[model samples]
Target: MYLTVFYALSFCACWRKMYFYKLNMAVRIMTETLIRNHLSHFEVAIAGCGGLGSNAAVALARSGIGKLFMVDFDRVELSNLNRQYFFYDQIGQYKAHALADNIHRIDKSIGLRTSIVKLDETSVTQLFATVDLVIEAFDQAAEKQMLLETMLVNFPEKPLIMGNGMAGFGKFELIKQQQWDKQVYICGDFTNEISEDNPPLAPRVGIVANMQANLALDLILKMRK
Candidate 1:
């Protein structure tokens, strides 16, 4: 595995390949240029690749985080035109698939993978074991809960970073999902109390998405040191 040539992981290659990630030399050079020293050693997975998830993907890839696995079920739509960077040509493409392709196009050097499947408690829990950490960026509360519940129960040790209160002018928080311990980080308006309920969405989403990327980068930095 090329990761063996660079990153050493608890999990090894799923299969052997001719060229790692199918990336060319130019991609390898550019990918390494933007990656920080601390992030060069590890991989981080993003489980939701919609508004927040998609933006976070760009941030992480630009920063040169080694690998990413984006997961989403829905196709891009006219509604996603506002904030997402995908093209009008990609209207029918799944968010996860689009993000994966975008990330690869952004930096083929990074080992990027994706699953275009709606996440269930079953698949997510099973998938969590293969990752170092998960960035949770679901648009729906129920889907968010599905990922959170599974990670909290079965992969408690894996860091689960999530966004909260990123809509209706609420604040943003990148919280660590823990079973027995709960710590919240708020970036916008947590005062409404109603923010604790309902779905999140906009500038707040932007705020939270950047924060989540920073949090993931921060964790990767700490792990490297």
Candidate 2:
């Protein structure tokens, strides 16, 4: 009788464990299916990996962008910690590689490509031609304007999303999206420039970067619909 009782209890325990394991596996598969349905088809290019670029890349990865191409010639510096994503130990490392490494830590399944080369008129168009969206995240106005124009000329059908006037603290209302022409969308305060009075800090810069990422995702979803 005691042997029969022991066998019955062991069977119940094993059955319960099997039931929960299957339940957990089912949940995981459902979650991945939902994410893939929404974000498994888009590719993105980030022009620079500074304050705006690094944060925007992270946002996109978390949002489940299928692939990313990031290019930045500069190395991580101590000053970049004020807003950028690199750690102190990552100082002197190339920004593109470091950003990609950090992003992988967040989602290893994401497709990542990094280029540690400076961009110019000749290289910009070719590098970003295949991407569904081009995010201009350079700190300087000249670079932003140059890349924006080059992209529009080369890939007139593609969308170019950028940020401008995001260098201040507070005044969140001013930081919004402005549609330029047909395929360009600029997100920022659009008035504040990086100066002594308006230094680029983390909060304001992240707000704008996230806005750009959200806008990019929104555009991609709209196209699918």
Candidate 3:
């Protein structure tokens, strides 16, 4: 009974501040003890670091996820300047590397790994073994489909989250997710409606990405019965 009371206090005080290298061994130990199945041991992978993916990564980082693995091969263009706040003067660099640096810079204690390669059959297999969750941020249908199919077949047990539909014709779903037998959660743009335009708008992307982030965290929390 006394141990339980002490455990409660450990989290309230020191654990909240532990993200940015702020915790000592005692606090980390006690806090980890209090939490259940924390994301500390598992790494979440975000594929496609464009606007939607970028925003989702930031939200997840702030949500106290212990480790993140971001993958993107494209470099920032002047066009990407509008939505990707995660992109800065560090233009021309690969998106994965730039975003990874930004995340680690924002919270030095957060474990962020990166892969600057386009998602493909070979790479998908290579990366899935290292990931506990997958977030699909690719804009193209083909890429999204490939990413989904690969993860489903290879790492069927890993939770996969994806985002689409942030623009054009106007079907805004505040949140949409799923748990396939393999634990796939498609976060945004589940509509069959195509607006002749892809990559939705800034607001739509942000909303869906936010939902994706929430869904990812919920999956991690496993609070849903």
Candidate 4:
């Protein structure tokens, strides 16, 4: 009789576990469906396809962004393999085109427009004018400043996300997100500038990049609601 009772209890426990697992899976599926349905209509432009831009673009693509306009004129180099998301075989390819191809492998349905031209103030305004949002992934301080000014001045209505000071190790807590105004959002430590000694590392760069992607998703979803 004791054996029969133990068997029955064990069966009940297993059944309960299976039931909850199925319930969690159902909820996850529903959430993903909702996100894809909503995000399939929105478009974003990522300026500069280096470490920050490459990582952020992949995150956004996986999140189901409908389209992406990638702009970068630089070619991938062996040194870029340390931080950026590019294979060694793709070293000679333009960053924008290579990134687009990689994003396609992840989600073929995602629309990609690649421009292998350097970005200036006029080009920045022209390329990003129609996109729902713009991401500033430039490495240089001057480029970051240029993009920020152009976006705020030329396209105040659209949202702009940027990464500022993600370099070197430790102090992960220093990485933060700040809203400069109603339209501009910045992410990073805001202190560790990339230089010869303090180079951009994968961990810190990826953190800032994913933060930008997360902010982009949040802003898009909120706007949809």
Candidate 5:
């Protein structure tokens, strides 16, 4: 009887030890997988800190992007609060500066940098030269064309992702991604535009911006491989 009791206690101890050992191994594996899958080494430049830019910046910062370069000349307006990420108190503040603060609030570890300056044809290349990826989030068609042209001419080697045509309701399926050319990817419906009658809303704009952020993250991960 004494021998049987001793053996039973020994088996219980061994089982508990093995169970903990496996749990620790699983935890270590999960940690390593997360580290390996992180895109924390890449820097992205987001031009135009309006709806698309600000939303995408928040997504990327949360996804573990190491650095961000946000550029925008516009100030946050009360109307912009409908789609943009700024708070009510941030009205009249530069979008770039406000966006950087907002992003830091989401992920304080992110290296948030802001340029409260206009990005024209001449300045586009210099502003985005150091970033690993570029996201064009301007609302105006003319500005989008200008930035697209500038990127193709100066930084043709880098990837330029832009969003367009995300302005209405019930057209969720239309909001998709397309590769315009080598090093150029466009996200949105490719048809709709915001106007006096059709104002920019949050849900659709957020969907498109999130898509751009996801695509950018995927591209960064692919580059790593």
Candidate 6:
């Protein structure tokens, strides 16, 4: 009778474990579905497909952003491979198109749109008018200022996330997020502009790029909630 009782207790414990396991799985599936539903409806536009833009676009796509609109007129160069996302073979291709291909490789279901034309104030206004958020990732200060001014003056309601001052190394702690206003957010050291003396390295640029992507996700999810 002792052996019989022992077997019954063991069976009961196994059944209990199985029941809780299935319950946890069901809860996980439900939660994932809820988050996916939220993210799958939001769209973002990334202006300038350089190091920050390329890395951030990939991060956003991996995070399951529903759609992305990318614009850049520059073609990939061998020097860009130091920090940008394009492969060696993609050196001659336009940044926008190459970025789209890379993003699609991560998630084929993500909606992608690309423009090879350069972004000016007018082009910025038109391309990003319908996107839920805009990410400014230009290399030059003038282009960055132009995009920022254009978006703020024209698309006042839309959120803009930008990367700035992510050059050099050993200043990882200096990189941070700054809020210009309700609709404008900037990430990076805020002082380390790329130059002949200070080059854009992958680690710092990637840190800032991912920060922008994370901020974009947080904003979109909170807005939906």
Q: CA lDDT, every prediction?
A: 0.68, 0.89, 0.74, 0.92, 0.88, 0.90
C-alpha TM-score for every candidate: 0.71, 0.83, 0.75, 0.86, 0.83, 0.85
Looking at model 4, report the run of 10 residues with the lowest lDDT sum. Answer: 24-33
What is the descending lDDT order?
Answer: 4, 6, 2, 5, 3, 1
Pairwise lDDT winner, candidates 1 and 2 = 2
Model 2, range 1-225, lDDT digits (tens) per residue?
Answer: 999999999999999999988996665334556655667688899999999999999999988888999999999999999999889999999999999999999999899998887898889976887888889999888999899889878888899999998887989888789999699999998899998877999999999999999888777765662
Screening candidate 3 with a backbone cut-off below 3 angstroms (N, C-alpha, C), the clashing residue pairs are 166-200, 167-200
Residue-level lDDT tens digits of model 3 in 1-225: 999999999977676776535544434443533332475555678889988788899888876777888888899777776677455587788888888888887778888888888889889999868677788888778998898888788888778887755665356644456655558777665664345455456676777788888788767765222
Clashes of 4: 0
- Cα deviation in Å at residue 99, candidate 6? 0.8
Candidates 1 and 6 compared by lDDT, better number: 6
lDDT of 5 by residue, 1-225 (tens): 999999999999999999988996765433534643566778999998999999999988877888999999899999999999999999999999999888888888888888888789878877788889999999899999999999999998889899989987777878889999899999999988898877889999999899999889878866752
Task: Name the better of 1 and 3 by TM-score.
Answer: 3
lDDT of 1 by residue, 46-154 (tens): 8778777888878988897877888887899977866675778889998888877888888888887778787898888767677777888786667767777787788
Model 1 misplacement above 4 A: 1-35, 169-202
Cα lDDT, model 2, residue 68: 92
What is residue 97's positional error in candidate 6, in angstroms? 0.6
Check candidate 6 and list the clashing pairs.
Answer: none
Q: What is the lDDT of residue 158 in candidate 4?
A: 94
Residue 128, model 4: lDDT of 83
Question: Which model scores highest in lDDT?
Answer: 4
Winning model by TM-score: 4
Local accuracy of candidate 4 as per-residue lDDT tens digits, 55-162 = 999999999999999999999999999989899999899999899989999999999999988899999877887899999999999999999999889998899999
Of the pair 1 and 5, which is ahead by TM-score?
5
- For model 2, what is the error of residue 114's alpha carbon versus the real structure, in angstroms, after optimal superposition? 0.9
Looking at model 2, residue 126 earns an lDDT score of 69
Worst 10 residues of 3 by lDDT: 27-36
